[model samples]
Target: MASFEVKGGNKLNGTIVPQGAKNEALQIISAVLLTAEEVTVSNIPDILDVNLLIELLEDMGVKVSRPSRDTCIFKADAVDADYLASEAFRNKGGKLRGSVMVAGPMLARFKKAFIPKPGGDKIGRRRLDTHIIGFEKLGAQFDYHDEEGFFQLSSPRLKGTFMLLDEPSVTGTANIVMAATLAEGTTTIYNAACEPYVQQLCKMLNSMGARISGIGSNLLTIEGVTALGGTSHRMLPDMIEVGSFIGMAAMTQSEITIKGAGVEHLGVIPDKFRQLGIQLEIRGDDIYIPAQEKYEITTFLDGSVLTVYDHPWPGFTPDLLSIMLVVATQAVGSVLIHQKMFESRLFFVDKLLDMGAQIILCDPHRATVIGLGRKHKLRGITMSSPDIRAGQALLIAALSAEGTSIIQNIEQIDRGYQYIDERLRQLGAEIRRL
Candidate 1:
C-alpha cells in the first residue's frame, strides 16, 4: 500500500553494489532445514519475501541468529512437525511462492511436508506439477485437501530413481534435488535446471556431504547421503539488479558503476543489453556505464527489426525483459520484445504507452517498441506496478521522464530490491517513498 513519488530528469552518478541474489537466497535458506547442525548463510538479502520465509522457519522452532545484517545462522535441531499441519503455515506460506520450496527438505527429513496454495506474480500459469511429480517419482505420496487448499506429502523413506522433467523449472529442480539428497539410492535427473542459483545450491549441499555431480549441466546425478552437516555459503550478487542498473543508467543518461556485480555469473545479460546498443565497460568485477545521448538498436545483416526474447538458462532471462522493454523505448531504433515464458508480463506496456512511448502490444506475450530515440522527452504519468520487474521498469521510466510520476503498489518492488528508494537516492535519484 505504499507509493513512490519520483521527480524525473536526474542524471545519477556514483557506485552502487548489487544486493545478494534473491532467488538463490530462497533456495538456500529453505535447504537449511535439511540439517540439524548450524548452517550459516552470508550475503542474505534483507527483503520482505526472505524475511517472511525466515520468520516462518523460526515459528517452526528453528533456532535463528543473525550475526550481521546480511548473515544468518540456522540450526534446526528441534522443529515442530505438528505445526506443519496447522493453519498458520497455510496462511503464511500462501503469501510467497518461495514458501513452497520448504516442502522438499521437510519431506526429506521429517517424512512429511505440507504447503498451502503458494502465491506469486500473475504473469502466467506457473504450475507445481514439476515439483509434485518429481517428489512422487522419488517415492513420496501426494494428497490434496480440497477444503483446506493445501498439499500434503509424506514418505516413509524416499527411494531415488531416474526421471526426465518436462521442463527445466528452477524451483522444481531445487526441490527435487534437496529431497533426493537423503533418499535411499541414486537419483538421476535429466532436463534439470542448471541456473547459477541451482548450481550454488548443489555446491552448498555437497559441502554438507550430499554427493551430486554435473553441477553446471542440465543433467544431475545425486547419491543420497544418510545426513547432511553444517556448512557456510556466500550468495552471488543479484544479476537481475545489475541488468536493471544498466538499463537505468542508459535511460537516465547516467554515469554509474556497479561494484561486485559478479559479472562472471551474469549469463547473457550484458550481451543482451549490448544488443540494444548500450556501451558497457567491465573493470575487474564491476560494470561501468557511461552517459549516452542516444544509442541505436542493432538489427540483423538483412536489416530485419531486432528481436529480444527470453528462454531457459544460458538464454536471456525473462525477468529482465521488462527493463529491456522500457529501455528500448529510449533507444534510437525499433525492437520486438518477446516474453515467451510469461504470457501476461507484456501487459505492462499499457503503462509505458501512457508515458508517451510508442509501443504496440502484439499479444499476451509479445510487444513491438519503436524507440523515440531521444527525439522527444517522455512525459510522466501515474501508474501502478503489477509485478516485481514491471515495478522496477516503471521506476526507471520515471527517472528518465520529463515530470513527476507517482507509482503505487510498491510492495511488489520491495519484495525483491532492498531499500530501493533509499539506495536510488544515494545515487542522486530524486525518489521518495510515501
Candidate 2:
C-alpha cells in the first residue's frame, strides 16, 4: 500500500546506475538449483520479485548467503523435496512468477516438481503451456490438479528432443534450457527467444559445464551433461530501466547520465528513444541524455506517421513501450505506440489523458499520441499504478507535471525499480514515499 508523493516540474540532474537485470536474475538464480555446488551471482537487483524468488529458494533448503547486497552465494545440494509440497511453499511459490523457473532445475536434478498458479503483473494472458509442453517434450509427465491449482510434473528420466516453440517465450526457453542441460541426449530448440537474458543464461550454463551453442540466435543446441558444476555469474544492467531513464530525462527536461548501462546489450533501445526525438549520447558504458525544451517524432521514410511497436529481441522491447508512450506526450509530433505483446497495457493511458495529454486509445493494443510539444504543461492528479512498466511510466508523467501527484500501488513500482524514489531524489526530484 505504499504510495509516492511526487512533486512535478522538477528538472532532474545527476548520474543514476541501472540495477542488475531483473529478468535475467530470475533465470540465473533458478539455475543455481542445477548443481549442489556453490553458485555465486553478482549484481543482483534488490527488488521484490527477485527477492521473493530468493526467499523461495531459501525455503527449499538452498543454502544462500550474501557477500554483498548485490551478490548471492547459493548451494542447492540439500534442496528439500518435501518443502515443494508444503502449504507454505504453495502459497509463497504461487506469489512469484519466477518460481516456475525452479521447477525446471528441480525436475532436472530431483525428478519431480510442482508449480502453483504463478502471480505477476496482470497485463494480459501469460500462458504456461509453453513451459509445460516443453517439459513434456523432454519426457516429463504433466498433470494439472484443479483442486490444488497446481501443475504436477514428474519423470523417471529426462531425454532431450527437438522442439519448435509456438512462440519465442523468454522464460519458457530458459526453463526448458535448464532442464535439457542435464538430459540424456542432445536437444535442439528452434524459434527460441534469444534475448540477452537467454544468451546470458546460455553463457553461464556453458561455464557450468553444459554444452550450448547459438548464443545470440533463434536456434539453440544443447548437449546434455550428466552433472553441472557451479560457477560465478554477473547480471547485465537492466535494459528496461535504462530505457525508462532515457524517457524520464527527455520528459522532465533534465540532464542525466546513466552509469554502467550495459550499452552494447541494450539492443535498439537507444535508437527507439531517438525515434521519439530524444537525444542521448553513448559514452563507454554510460548513456547521457540532455535537457530539452521540445523534441519531435520521426516519420517513416515514405512520409507515413511514425510507429513504435514491440517485437521479439533485436527489436523494440514491449516493456519500454509504456515509457515511449509517456515520453511522446510532450514531444513535437505524433507517434503510434503498438503494444503487440500485451493488450491491457495501453489502458493506463487514460490516466495521462486526465492530465491533459492528447492520446487516442485506438484499441486495447494501440495508442496514438499527439505530443503537446511543451506548449502546455501537464497538471498533476492522483493515479494508481497498474503494473511495473506502467507504474514507472506514470511516475515519469508525475515527475514532469506542473504540481504534486499522488501515486498509489507503488509496491508494483518497487517490484521492478530499486529504490526509485531515493534515486530520483538524488537527481533533485521531490518525491516522498508514504
Candidate 3:
C-alpha cells in the first residue's frame, strides 16, 4: 500500500528516456522457453510483473543470467515441465497475466502446459478463450477445472493449420504464433493482433530460425521447424510511456524531450496527440514536446466534437486513452474519450471530477471531458490507483494540479513502469514514493 506525495504546479523540463516496452518484453521473454539454447534479450523494462514472470521461469528451472541492468540471457535446457503442475507455480504464476504466455512455449517444447487463473488489472474481463481456442486448433487439447481454477493443455506433436481468432488479442496472437513456430506443418493466422509488440515477437522468432511472414499485418503465415536456436532481440521503446509523456507535457505546460523513442514503430500515437493540439517535434529518434499555456482539442472537419477511441494496431492504442482523458481535462475544448477495449477503465473519471475537472461519465466505456480551458486549475486530492494505465493518468493529473496530492496503492504503477518516480524526478517533477 505504498503512496505517492506529489506537490503539483511545477512544470517539468528535461530529457527522459522511455523504458523498454513492457507488453513486448512479456511476450519476448516468454518465447525464450521455446528452445534449449541460450536466448539473450536486451532493453527489458525493470518492472514488477516482468520480474515475477522471470521468477516463475526460474522456478521451473530455466537458467537466467543478467549481465546488465537491461539485459538477460535465458537457458531453458533444464526447464522443469513438472513444475508447471506444482502448487508453487499455481500460487506464483497466477500473479501476472504475462505468466499465461509461458503456456505457448511450454506446450510447444514439452507438449504440456498448466496454469492457474491469471491475475492482472481489473479493468475488464480479459478472457482466455482466444488463446485456448487457438491452441485447440493447432492440434492441442484443452481442459479447465472451474472449481480448481486451472487450465491444462497438452499436445502430442502439434501440427499447424489455418485458424481465425475471434478477436485480435495481443497475448492470444503471441501464444499461438509461438506454438505454431515449432509445429509440424504450416500455420496461417487471420485477424491476429499486429501491434508492434506482436510484430517484434515475430521478428525475434524468425531470427531464431522460425519462419514467420507478414511482420506488421493482421494475417501472419508461419512455417514450422524442428527447433529454434538462440538469438538476441531488443524491445521497442514503450509507446504507452511515450504517449503518457506527451499528455503530461501538455497538461503540466512542460518542455520535455523523450530520448530513444523509436518513432517509426509508434504508429498513429504521435498523430493522435497532435489531434489534441499538442505540438511535438520529431528530432531524430527523440520526441520533443514544448511547453504550452493551453492546447486546444481539434474539431472534426464538419465542426463536430472530437472523438478519441482505441482500435487494433494502426489505430490509437487503448492503453493511452486514460492518459488522453486526463490531458483533455486541461485542453481548450470538449472531447469524447471512448475506451472500447475495456469496459470499466473510464470509471476513474469520478476521481478526476473530484479534483475539479468537468467530466460527464456517460457509461462504462465512455466519458465526455469538458475542458476547464485553463480557466480553472485542477485542485489536488487523495486517490487510489485502480489499474496501471489509470494510475499513470492520475499521476499526470496530480503533477498538473494546483496543490499536493496523495496517491495510494502505487504497486499497480510499479507493475508496468520501471522506477517511474525516479525517472520523473530527473525531469524535475515533485513526486515522492513512500
The C-alpha TM-scores of every prediction are: 0.99, 0.99, 0.99
Give the per-residue lDDT digits (tens) of candidate 3, residues 273-363.
9999999999999999999988999999999999999999888899999999999999999999988988988888889999999999999
Clashes of 3: 0
For each candidate, the alpha-carbon lDDT, in order, equals: 0.95, 0.94, 0.94
**In candidate 3, how many Å is residue 190 off?**
0.7
What TM-score does candidate 3 reach? 0.99
Please give the RMSD to the true structure for each candidate, in Å: 0.7, 0.7, 0.7
> Which candidate do you rate higher for lDDT, 1 or 3?
1
Model 3: lDDT of residue 21: 96
For model 2, the superposed segments whose C-alpha errors exceed 4 Å read: none
- RMSD versus native structure for model 2: 0.7
**Cα-based lDDT at residue 269, candidate 1:** 97
For model 3, where is the 10-residue window of minimal lDDT?
141-150
lDDT string, candidate 1, 1-434, tens digits = 89999999999999999999999999999999999999999999999999999999999999999989799999999999778789998889889999998999999999999978878787888889999999999999999998999999999999999999999999999999999999999999999999999999999999999999999999999999999999999999998999999999999999999999999999999999999999999999999999998889999899999999998899888999999999999999999999998888988888888899999999998899999998888888999999999999999999999999999999999999999999999999999998
lDDT of 2 by residue, 1-434 (tens): 88999999988999999999999999999999999999999999999999999999999999999988899999998999778877898899887888899889999999999998888898998889999999999999988888888888999999989999999999999999999999999999999999999999999999999999988999999999999999999999999999999999999999999999999999999988998998999999999998888899999999899999999998888999999999999999899999998889999998999999999999999999999999988989999999999999999999999999999999999999999998999999999999
